[model samples]
Target: MNKPMFGIDFGTTNTRIAFYDGETVELVKIRNPDSGVDVANIPTQAGFDEKNGNWHFGFDAEGFKQPKDSMKWMLLRDYPVEEISGTESKELVTLFFHHLKAVVAEARADEYEGQELSHAVLSIPVTFSLEERRALCESVEAAGIVVEQIYYEPVSALYAALRENFRQMPIDENLSGRIAVFDWGGGTLDIAIATIRNGFLYILKRDTLLRGGKDFDQIIVEKAMQDLKSKYNRHLDSYIETAYHQKAADLKKTAERIKISLQNRDNFALNYPRFIPKGAVNPPVEEDINLNFPVLKENLRNWIGKDIEQGIELLKECICQTGIPLDDIGLATRCIILAGGTSNLSLIEERLLEEFGTLKFGPLEKIERVPPIETYSSEPRRFFSSDKFGREDDASVATAVGNALLAADGGIPTFTCDIGLIVLSPTGQPYPKRIFQEGSPLPIDKPIIRQLPIINRGQEVISIQIYFQSIGYIKGEFEIHVDVKEHTVEISFHVDRYRILRVSGTGKNYPKRTQQSQDAIMDFPIAFRLPEKLKT
Candidate 1:
C-alpha cells in the first residue's frame, strides 16, 4: 500500500498512532521540538460534559476532573456503529477521532511541513466480529482518512516489529515449520498458529479468549473492595472519590504494573497512598501503602497465563490429530513466528520450550529468536506528559504497532483461511469434493470447478448447498450456513502434510461472475481462530 499508509490503535486504556514510511515503522506521539518531550500513546480516558455531550480526550480530558462530568471508556472493536456500556460507539469514536484529528492537524502543520494527509490504517482486536469490523470501517470513514486494509493485530506485529529489525529467518528450503502465537493483552488473550509456505503467510489455526489485564484488574479490585468493606464494617460508598472508584482505578493500575514488572522482576508492589474511612470525607488512615507480590516461577504458574493451559492443550490436541509428530512441524513448513501483545512475557518462551519437550520436532532441529520484541510506546501518556519512554513500560501495544505496519506495507500475503457452508444437494460428492486438499501449500489451487450437479432438465432446477467445514482442528464442529440457489461459493483453504487444517473454509457467494472471481459476495473472512486440532 504505497502512497503513505496510516495505522491507528484505539485501545481500552490507551491509543496509539503510527504510519509506515515505506521503509520503517515508527510510533507517532506528542514530540516537542524545543523541550524534546516525547509523550506518545496517550491514555484512552475521555471526559464528557454533563450539559452537552461534548468530549475532551487524552490529557485534556484527564486533567480537567469535575464532579459533574464522567470519564468515558473507549470501545475497542471493529463493529460498525454499535453500543458500549451505555454510550453509542459511533458517537464515542467520532469524539475520539475529533480530538485525534486536532492533534494530527497540529502535527501536520508542525512536523511534516504541512502536507495534507489522506490515507491511514487502524488496528483491531482479533475478537472483533464482522459487524464490529464494519462499524470500525465506518468510524474510520468518519475520521476522514482512507483505510486501505485492516490486519489482525497479532500478524501485524511481524510486519512492524520483527520485519523492521530482523529480516532474516533462513528463507532457504532447509528450515520450515509452524509456530504457536499466544498473545495476552488488557482485555483478551488470543492464541494463533501460522506457517509461512513458499514465501507466503498462512494462519493455520487461532482463537481468542476474553480474559486479560483488564479482567485481572477487575478481579483484584472487586476482591479488595469486598475485603475492605467487610473489615471496615461501614458503608464506603460516600467516599466515591478515594474509596469506591479510586481503589478500583488504582488497583487496575497496580494490576497493570505487576503484569509488566513480572516480565523482568519476579516481584513488584501495589501502591496506595490514602485509606479513606467509612462515612468520612477526609478521615484518613494512611501510610506508604504497598503490597509486594513476588511473581516467582510458582506465582506465574498460578497466575493468569495458567488459564491458557486448556487452550494450549486444545492446540496440542489439534497437533496430535494430524498424526504428524511434533518433530515434523518445522519440516512441514518453514519457521514459527511469534507476534502479539502478551507475548512479551518471559514465561511465554519458557512455557513453549517446556511444551516442545525435546525441542526437536520432525525435521525441526533448532528454534531461533530473531530480535527482542518491543512496543512502540511503553509508558502511554494520559492527559499528561511523561518523563521518559521504554522505561515506564507497556506490553499490549504491539498489535497496534503491527496494524500500523500492515497499513504502510503495500500488499498483505495470501492466507490459509477458508469459509464453510452446506450445499443441500440430493447427494454428497461421490469423490472427496476436494477443490482444495487439506494442508496443501496456501494460495490454494483454485481448480476450474465445473460439472457442479444441478438437476435442470432431469426434473426441475435443482440447487445444492455446498457443505463448508474446517478439518482436523476439532472432531467436527464447522461453522455451518446455507448456500442458497444462484449463489456461487468461493473457498480458501490449506491443510498440512498430515491433512490437518490450520485455517478453514471461508464461504463467499456471488450472484453473477461478471469477470470477477466466482465467489465475491457473502465474503466471510473468519478471524484466524485455532480449533482443537492444530494446537501444540
Candidate 2:
C-alpha cells in the first residue's frame, strides 16, 4: 500500500506523464532534465550509433539525415508482432520495460532531479494480442517500475479524455448514421465510428483504418519535392533528391500548420520561409515557396477526402456486419466520446456535421450532401479541443498514459506453449494434435475426451493426437515423443500468452472417435469467441 503509483503515457510524437498524488493525477511532462530528452520534440527522434555504440537524441536527433531509432516509438501497442522483425523481437515485456527505463532515466536526470522511480500504470491499443499485451507488461518490468496495472488505450483515453468536445453531440451505433473519427496523425490514421446507445456515452462499434494525419503530411511532403524538382528543372534524375531531406521536414511542418488552419478557415497562407520541426532551414524564394495561400479548403479536402469517406464507409460496413439495424442504433445511441489527436480536423468535423450537424446550421440539402460534400468542405470547421484535460499535452499523451495504467494492473501477464499430439487416422495410426495457439489469452486451459469403443482386454492402446490449428488444419504432433497406453483416451490442453503452452496428459482408451466430437474439440486459451474457421 505504501507504493507510489504513477501514470506514464508515451505517445508517437510526444510524451506526457503524471503521478497519482494519492488523489488527482498531476501532469508530469518533465523529461530527463539532465538528458537531451527534457527538451520538447527531442525524445522521439533519438538514435543510437552501433559502431561506437553511442546514443544520440533530442531536437538534433529529429533533424538527422540518417534513419534514427526512436526509443519511445518502440513501445507501439496493438502490433501483431508475429508478422514483425528486428525490434519486434524486443517485444517481450521485459525488453519493453528496459526501453522505458532508459527513457525514464533520461527524463529523471533531466526532469525529476533524479528521484527514484517507483510504481507505474500504462495503456495500449484496444485490440492487442495476448502476447503483445504480455510484451507490454515486460516493458514495465524492464523499466524497473513496479507495474500497477494495464488497460486498453481507448478505455484509458476514455478515463482521461477531454470530454467537452463530443459530450453534447448526437450519437449513433449504426455506422450509416455517420460518426467519423478523422484521426490524421504522424504514424497511423486510426478511425472508428460511434452510435448513440441511449443518450449516454457514445459507444463505439466499428473501426475504419489505422492510418492517421501524418500520412497526409507525408503526402504533401512528397508533392513539395516533386514541385521543387519541376521548378529547378534539373537534367539529373536525382533532381532535388539531395534537397529531399530538409524539404520534406519543412513540408511536414507546413502541412501541420496548413492542416490546423484548414479546420476553420477558407485557406492556409504558406509563408516563404517556414521553420521546420527538424530544424532544416529553408528560405524559399517567393516563387519557389509560392504562397499557396488558400491551399483552398476544397483542394486540401480533395487530397484526403477519399480517405475520410472510406473511413466513414468502413464504419458503416462494420456496423452492417454487426447485423444491427440503423434505426436501432440511432434511437438507442447515447453520448459520444471522441478521443484522439486527429479528431481535431475541421474538414472531418464539417463533413461530419453535414450528417449529424444540428438544425442550427439549417437546411439538410443546402448544408448536407449525399456523401456530404461528396467532396471536401471549405477549410475551418469549428473545433472544440475537449476541455476534459487541462494541459495541451493531455490530448496527445492520454493514450500513452493509459497504456502505463495497463502495465500497473499485472493485467498483461501470461505464459504460452504448444500442446503435443494430433488428430489420428482411423487405422490406429497417430495424428499430431496441437493444444495451444500463439497469442492466446490468459489462464486458458481446456480438456477434450474421446472414447474409443474397445472389447474386453483390448490390447490395442488408443493413441490420441493432440495438436493446434495451423494455416488451415491441425498442425503436426508436437516435436516431442509420447506413448499410448489405452484404447480409450482423453486429452487436455493448456496455454497462456507467455509460455505459449505446456501439454501433458492422462487418457482413457479412446478410439473410433466421432467426426462430430473431433470437430468440437476445444483449444487451450479457450475463451475467445473464435472465428468459424478456427472453431474446429
Candidate 3:
C-alpha cells in the first residue's frame, strides 16, 4: 500500500491538515492538549516555559503565561534572527512541525498506527519566493515530513470552494468561467482571479497585501487604549512597557472579543473586572483596572474601514489583471468566493456586495444587528458560545481541503501565470514573446520550440531572458555559448505536472561543425520568481 499523502495548509496564524488516500478526503482534526478539544485548526505558534524548560505549541502555547513566539515568517524570509524562546527561529519552526507531525500521527493512529508519517502536499501564499518555500519545506522535512509538492493558497482555496458549493468535480467539463477568491487571513490578504475551462483550473492573476485580520485586531486594541485613557485617566502603556506584559496580552484578547462581538451586534460592553492585576500598578498611582467601555459597530467600521477599502482596491487590481472590467465584474465573474477568517467582517461583505451586486453562486448575508453580549456575568466568556468564528464554518480550512482534493486526484491545475522570453534586439530593444499563456493545462507533452538568429556576427554567447506574469523574471537568463559558426540557437520549453519548467537549448550547427554536442537543459520551478531587473 502507498503511504498516505497529507495536504498541509501552513497558514500565518493557524495551520490545518488533511489526508486523501485515493478513496476519501479526511479533514484531520488536531487534539489540543491544553483544551482537550478536537479542533480542525491550531494557531501557528510556539512557546517555551522558562521555569520548567518545556516547549508548547498551538492552543497549548497560546495559553502559556509567557508571550508566545510568532516568528515563523522571520524564518521563512531568511531574516537574520538571533533567538526565539532561547533557541534559533528555524529550530523553533522545526519543533512546531515536529509537534504537528506527532498530533497528526495520533489523530490517524486508529488506521495508520506505527506507520511512518511522511509525504505532504503543502500549500503556500503565491507571493512566497523560491528561497522562502525551500526554507519552509526544509523545516517541515526536518520534522520527518517529506513535502511532495507546494501549491498556491488561492488555487487550493478555489478548488475547495468549488467542491463545497457546486459539487462540481474537477473532471466535469461542463462547468467553466471566471472566478475570484478573496482570502483574507490573519497575516495577509490574498486576492486571486482564475478561470475554469475544459475541466482545468487556471489561475490568471494573484496579489497580496500585508494587512489582514491581525491588523484589524490591532486597530481595535489601539482604539480601546485611547478610550481607556480618555475615560478613566489611567494608562497601562507604562506598565506594558515595563514588566506587566500579561496586561497587554490580556487587553489584546479583549479587543479581539470586542471585534468579534461587534460583528454580530451594534455595540458590545468591554467589561473586565481587575483587568490589570492588582500588584502591577503601584499604590497612589492607580487602582486595579476594572475596565468598562462600550464599543460600537460604527467604531469598528471607522477603525478598519480604510484597510478594507485598500483590500478591495487590491482585489479590483487582481480582477483587472485578468482583463475583466471592473464595471462588468458581476456579469463576467461566475462567482466570488470569500475565504479566510477576516472574510467574516460585515463591512467587507457589504463593500463587496455593493461593488459586485448579488453573486451568481450565492446570496450575500445581510448584517443583522443583535443585542450585545451579556456583561453582567462575573467571569470572562467568549463572544460566541460555539467557539468557531467566521463564515461557512471558517473559510481558513478551504486551502487544506482543496489540497487534499488535489492529493486525491480530484482536481487538475493549469498555469496561472504566463511564461515567456524577452528577446533583445541589436538596437538594445526588448520584445517579449510568450511561450505558454495562462490557462494552459499542466504536464505538457510536447515542447514549444523557438529559433533565434544570432544578432551579431561571431557572437559567442546567446542569452535567453525568461519572465513570469510580466513583472518578475528569473535571475540569470540562460546563457548558451557556441564556437562552431552557428548563426542561430534553437530552444524548447515545457512544463511538467509539478509545474517545473524544462528548457533545452542547442547551437543550430553544432552537430555539423563540431564534434562536441551543444545541447543543454535547464529546469526551473514555475513558482520561482525574482524582481524583474530587465523589462519583459
Candidate 4:
C-alpha cells in the first residue's frame, strides 16, 4: 500500500493535522491516550524532564510539574537563552515533533494499516527566515517523517478559501481579481495580497506582525490586574510572585475564557478567589469581577486598532509595490478573506470592514451591524451555508486544510527570492553581480556560473565574498588558493527546493605546467528577507 500523505500546520498555540483519503480531506482527531477523549487540536507545549533526562510533549508535558515552554514563535527568531524556560529551543522543537508523530500514528491507524507515515507538507509563517525553515525541516526529519514541501500559512488558508468559495463566484472574475488573506492566529498576524492567474496563486506582497490573540489576552490580564487594584487597593503582583506558575496560568486562562465568552454575549461576570500569600493578609480575599462589553471592546480597539490600520497600509503598500493603481485595487479586489483563530474577534471584523469595505466573515452571522453576502449563485447552496470545513467560528485549521488540498493537487511549492546576489573583490569591497535577480522564482534548476581570472602570480589565497542586496550583509565567503599552474577559477551556484544554496567549482590551469586540479563544494542555507523596494 502507498504511504498516506499528511498536512501538518504547526502553530504557536495549537497544532492541526489533515490528510486526503481519495474522496475528501478530513482532519485527524488526536485522542488522549489515558482519557480516550478526542481533542480538536494539540497544544504546542513541551518540556525537558531533568530527573529522567527525557523529553515530554503536548498533553504528556502538561502533567509535568516543572516549567514547560512553548517554542512556537520563539524558535523562528533569535531569542535569548534565558527567556526560553531553561531548555534548548531545538530540543523542545524535536520533542514536539516526536510527540506529534505518535499522535498522528494513533489517529490514522486504520487508514495507514501498518504503513509508516512517509510524506507531509508543513505550513510555516510567511516571515520565517531561511535558517528557521531549515531548522523546522530538520526537526521534522529527526522525528522520522519526510517533509515533501514547505508552504506559507496564509497561502494555505487562501487555498482553502478558494476551494470553499470558488464554485459560487465567477471563476474568471475571481481569478483575475486581487485577494487579500488576513490571518490572525494565536501568535502572529499575517496579511498576504495575491491574485490567481492560470490556476496558480501569485503572491504580490505580504506582511507579518508579531501580534495576535495572545496579545489580546495579555491586554485583558493587564486590565484585570488594574481592576483588582482599584477594587481591593491591593496589588496581586506580590501574590503572583509567590506562586508564579500557578497564578500566571490561572490569570491567563481566566482572561482567555472571558475574551472568548465576550464574542457571543455582551458581558461576563467572573467570580474567583484571589491569590493571597500566607501571612501577607489577615483575611483571605475573594474577588468579584464584572467585565463590561463596552469596556472590553474599547480596550481591544485601543490595543490593536493601530495594528489593523497598519495591515491596511501594508496592503496599499503592496499594491503600490506591484505597480497597480490605488483606484484599481478596489475594482480588482473581490473580497477581504479573514482566517485564523483571532479573526473571530468582532473587533477585528469591524476594523477590517471599515478599512477594506468588503469583508468575508465565513458564517459568522451573529456579528452585529455587519452585512452578509445577500445574493448567491444557483450552485450547491449547502457549501456556502457555514464555514465549509464543518467547523463553527474556527478558521484556525484553515492552513492545515489548505495544505492537504495542495498536497493532493501535486505541485512543487515555489517561492521568490527577495534579494539579489553579489560578489566581492579581494580588497574587501563588495561588487554587485546579479547571480540571481530579486523576485526570481526559486529552486532554480540551472546553475549560475562565474569565472575569476588570476590577476597576480604567487597569490596564495583567493577570497570571494557574497552579499545579499536586501539584507545588507555578507552572506558568506569562499576561499580558493591559487596554484602556480592555475589560470582561472570557476564557481557555480545552485539553489535547491528547500532554499539551500550549493556552490561548487573547478579551476582551469595554464598550459605547460601540469594543470592543478581543484574540486571544492560549499553549502549555504539562504534566509528570507523583505524586498529592497519594500523595506522601510
Candidate 5:
C-alpha cells in the first residue's frame, strides 16, 4: 500500500500539518510529550539547552529559561545571524519536521501500524523565492520526509475556501472572479491579488511586508514599558533588562496573549514579576500592566497604522495593474479572503472593509468573532459550515488543510514565477532582459531559447552567465570551447513547477552538451522589490 501524503504549512508563528488518508483529510494534532497539551499548531521556535548541549523545539524550546532562536522568515533572506549558524537553523527546522512525522505516525498507529510517513506537499508564502523554496525542501528532506510538491500559501487558502463555500455560491460552468488575500502572520504580511478563471487561481500581484504580528507585539511591549516608567517613576535596572532580554521568547508570548485577550474584551492586564527595579532595591519589582482597548487600539494605529494604509494602497495598485476598475472591483472580486493568525485582529478587517467595501465571506461584525481552537476540522464541508462563515482558528491552519486537499487532488493550477528572468551580457556587465516576466504560468514545457553568435574569431571558449533581474546572484552559467567553424551557440531555458531553472546550451559543431546541461541546475533568486515598487 502507498504511504499517506501530508501537507505542511511552515508558518512564521505557528506550523500546522495535515494528512490525506486516501479518502479523508484530517489535521494532525501534535501533543507535547512532556506537557501532554494537545496543540493544533506548533510554535516555530527552537533553543539550545545550555546544560545538556542539546537542541529543543516548539513548546520544549519555548519553555527554556534562555531565549529561543526563531528562524521564521530568515530562510527567505540572506541575512547572517551572529549567534545561530545557517546549519543550526536547518537542523532546527529538520528537528521540527521530525517531530511532526512522529505525531502523524502516532495518530495513524492503529490503521497503518508501523508505516513510515513520507510524501508531503508543503505550502509557502507567495513572495518566497526559488532559493527559499529550495532551502525549505532541503530542510524537510533532511527530516526523512519526501516533499512531493510546494503550493503558495494564499493559493492553498483559496482552494480550501472555494471548496468549502462552493455549495453556498452559484455553480457556473465559467466561474471567474478576483480574490484579494490579506495574509498577515507573525513575521510577514503578504497581500496578494489573484483571479479565479475557469476554476483555477492565478496570482496577478503580490506585495509583501517584512512586518506582522511580531511588530505589533514589539510595539505593545515598548508601550507597556513606557507606561510603567511613567506610572511608577522607576526604570528597569540594567540587570533586569538583561535578564528580560534573555527571556525574549517568554516576553513575546506574554505580549501575544495580551494582544489576543484584548481582541474581544475592553481591557486586558499584563502582569509580570520582577519586571522593574524599585530605586536601588537589590531585587526587582513586579508590574501590573493594564491596557484598555481604546489605548491599545490608538497605539496600534499610531505605530503600524501607516503600514496598514500602505497595504491597502498596494491592494488598490494591484487592482489597477490588473486593469480591474475600482468601482467594479467590489462586484468582480468574489471575496476578500483573510488568512494568517494576525488577521484575527478586528483592526485589520476594519481597515480592509473600509477600503474595499465588499467582503464575500461576510461583514466585520459577522466574521470577527474568535472560535475555540477545538472546533477546527480537516473535512471540507464540516470545515467551512461548522460556524456561520468559518472558525477563527481557520485562518491559522487553512493553508495546511488546503495544501493537503491539493496534494490529494493532484495539485491545482497556479503559477510560480514572481520576477523577471535576466542574464549577464557577454561584455561581462550585468545586462537585464526579461526571459519570463513575473506572474507567468508555471511548468513551462516549452524552452525559451536565445542564440548567441561567436563574433570574436579564434575565441577559445564561449561563456554564458544567467542572472535574474530581481535576484542579484548568478543563477547558472556554462562554458563551451569555441569550435572555430561554428558560428552560433543556442542557449535554452526551461523552468519547472518547482521554479528550478534548467539551462542548456548547444553548439552547431558540438552535439554532446549533456554534461554541460547537467551542471546548469541552479535555483533562481528573486529580488526584494516591494519598497522599490512603493517608491515608483
Candidate 6:
C-alpha cells in the first residue's frame, strides 16, 4: 500500500484527522476507551497534573479530577505563556498533538500498525501570524509529524463543499461561477468569496469574525451562573481566571452540553449537584451550591442575536470586497456553501434565508432542465443552498474532509495574509509597505525589487525589517564587502512554494576599487496571519 497521508484540521475548539487515498477519503475515528464509543473529533484542550507531573489531553484533560489548567486557545497567540504556569504553551501544544497521534495510532492499529503517520496536510486560521505558524510547525514536528502543506480553513471547507455537493457535474459544464463559503466554527467565523473556473478555485476575498459557537457557549455559561446567584443568593463564580479548579471545569462542560441540547430542542434544564463546593468562593460560602437553571430557545436567541447579526454584516463586507456588482453576483453565483459546526444553527440558517431568497439543495433535489440565463436579466433569485451535504452534522467535518481530498489530489493554497516590509516615514515612525497582497496563489512568480539609500557608507552592513500583517517583525542584515562609491543597495524578495522567502541584496554599482558586484542571499521561512480588527 502507498504511504498513508493524514489531513489534520487543528481547530481552536476541536481537532479532526482523516486519511485519503487517490480515490476515496476516510475520516479517522477515535474510539473512546472510557466510553467505548467512537467520536469524529477531539477537543483542542490540555491539562497539566501537578501531582504526577503528567499531561492529559482532550476528553482526558476535561475529566482530570485535579484543578483544571485552562490551555484552550493559547496556540493562537504569538507569546502564549502569559496565563499558563508550570510549562510553556508550546510544550503543552506539542504534547496535545502527541497525545492526538497516540490516540489515533491506538484506535487504528489494525490498518496502520507498522506504517508511520508522519506526513500530513494541516489547516489553520487566516489570522495566524508568522511566529504562530512557525510554532505550530515546530510543535507538530516535535510530536513526530511532518507538515506536508498548510491550507487556510475557509478555503479547505469551500473546496470540500464544492467537490462533495457538485461531484456529478464537470467543472467546465455547470460548475463555473462565483462562490461564497460561510465557515462558522467554534472560535472564528471565516467567510471567503471566490470564482471557480475550469476546476480552479481562485479566492477573490476573505474575512474573519473573531466570534463563533464558543462565544455563544460562554454567554450561556455566564447567564447560568447569574441565575444561580439570583435564585440561591449565593455566588457560583468558580474563580476560573486565577484558580482553574474542578468546579469551573464542570460548569463549563455543563454549559457546553446545554448549548448543544438547545440547538435542537425548544428549552433545556441545566441541573448540576454541588456546582460550587463549600468555601470555593471568597466571602466564604456556608454550603455547597446546586444549579437548576431553566433556559429557553428564545432566551438563547436574544442573548446571541447581536453577535449573529455582526456575523451577517461580516459576510456582507466580504461580498462587497469581491468587487462584483450585487446584481451580477446574484446572477453568477453558483452556491453559497456553509461549513463548520456553527452553521448547523437554525437561527443562522433562518437569517441567511431572510437575507437572501429561498435556498435550494441541488444534490438532494432532482436537477431539472432550466432556461439559460439572459445577460440582461434583472430578477433577484436565491444564490445559496438552504442546506448542505444531506447529513446531520456534516459541517463539523467539511474542512477535514476537504483537506483529505486535497492531500490526495494536491490542492493549490492561496496566500491568506499580507506580506510587506517596515518602512520609516519622515517623522521616523515605521509602517508596513505591502508588496504581496492577500488572496494570491502561493509561490509568487515574480520578485519584488526595491532600492534603498545607504545610510552609513562607513558600515558595509545593510539591515532590513519585514512585517507580517499586525503580528510582529523580523530583522535581517546583509553585508556587502565592496567599495562605498555606490550610494544605493538593490534588494530583491522572492517567495517560493514552501512559503520560504529568499532575499538577496547587492551594491547597485560596482566600485572602481574592485569593479565587481557582491551578492548576499538570505533565506527566511515565512508565513502570514491577519489582524483582529477587520480592515474596512
Q: Per-residue lDDT tens digits of candidate 3, residues 1-536?
A: 13356788887767887766655455667765554767777677666676787778776775454333244466753233333345666677788888888777667744344544577788877677655666777888888887766688877787665555444212334234467888887778888887644444556688899887767767766666666666645565665344334555456656766776776789987666765666867553456766677889987888788888898889878887788787866567666677776776777777776766544334322212112222211011111113333222366677887776665553434454677776555568667767776655555456778877767657666666777764476533666767637777777776543344666566776735423323333333332111111001
lDDT-best of 2 and 3: 3
Candidate 1 per-residue C-alpha lDDT over 1-536 given as tens digits, one digit per residue, 9 for 90 to 100: 45455577666556666655655444556653333666555556555454564566676654332222111223343232222224566656666776776776666523333433356666566677645665666766677766555666656654443443344443321124554545565556565565544444455555677665566555555555555555546454455335555445445656655665777776664545445532255455453223333334445546556555654565555444445476565344322334433445566546654665333222334435333223212211110122212433234445555665554443343324333333334454322244433333224223333333332222222222333345322122233232344333333343321112332333234224212222222222322222111122
Residue-level lDDT for 410 in candidate 1: 39
- Report clash pairs, candidate 5: 470-527
- Measured on C-alpha atoms, candidate 6 has an lDDT of 0.62
Misplaced by over 4 Å in model 4 are: 1-3, 31-39, 47-55, 63-69, 76-86, 109-116, 167-174, 235-237, 240-245, 269-274, 277-299, 358-388, 414-485, 504-536
TM-score of each: 0.64, 0.58, 0.74, 0.74, 0.74, 0.74
Residue-wise lDDT of candidate 2 within 46-67, one digit each (tens)?
Answer: 3334455443443433333323
All-Cα superposition RMSD per candidate: 9.5, 10.7, 9.0, 7.8, 8.3, 8.6
Q: Where's the lowest-lDDT run of ten residues in candidate 6?
A: 375-384
Candidate 4, residue 174: the lDDT equals: 21
Which tens-of-lDDT digit does each residue in 402-488 have in candidate 5? 777766655433333433333333566544445665435444356777766666545556666666543356656667664656666
Against the correct fold, how does model 5 do in TM-score? 0.74
Question: How does each model score on lDDT?
Answer: 0.46, 0.43, 0.63, 0.60, 0.61, 0.62
Any runs in candidate 5 off by more than 4 Å, and if so which? 1-4, 32-37, 65-69, 76-87, 109-115, 167-173, 232-237, 276-304, 358-392, 412-481, 487-497, 506-508, 511-536
State the lDDT at 153 in candidate 3: 82
Clashes of 1: 51
Best by lDDT: 3
Evaluate residue 432 in candidate 1 and report its C-alpha lDDT on the 0 to 100 scale.
Answer: 25
Instruction: List model 4 lDDT by residue over 1-536, tens digit each.
Output: 12246888888767888776644566677765655867557767664465776667676665443333246655644343234345556656776787777777777646554544556888888888767888888878877777876778887887766665552333342245566788888788887888755434567677788777767777776666556556555554555445435455445556666677776776665444534434454354444333322335555567667766776677677766666788776666655666787776767666656655532323323322223454222122122233334443357777887777666654334333343333344556544555665434555446777776655545556566565555466766666655656757667777754556766555656333333324332233222222121111
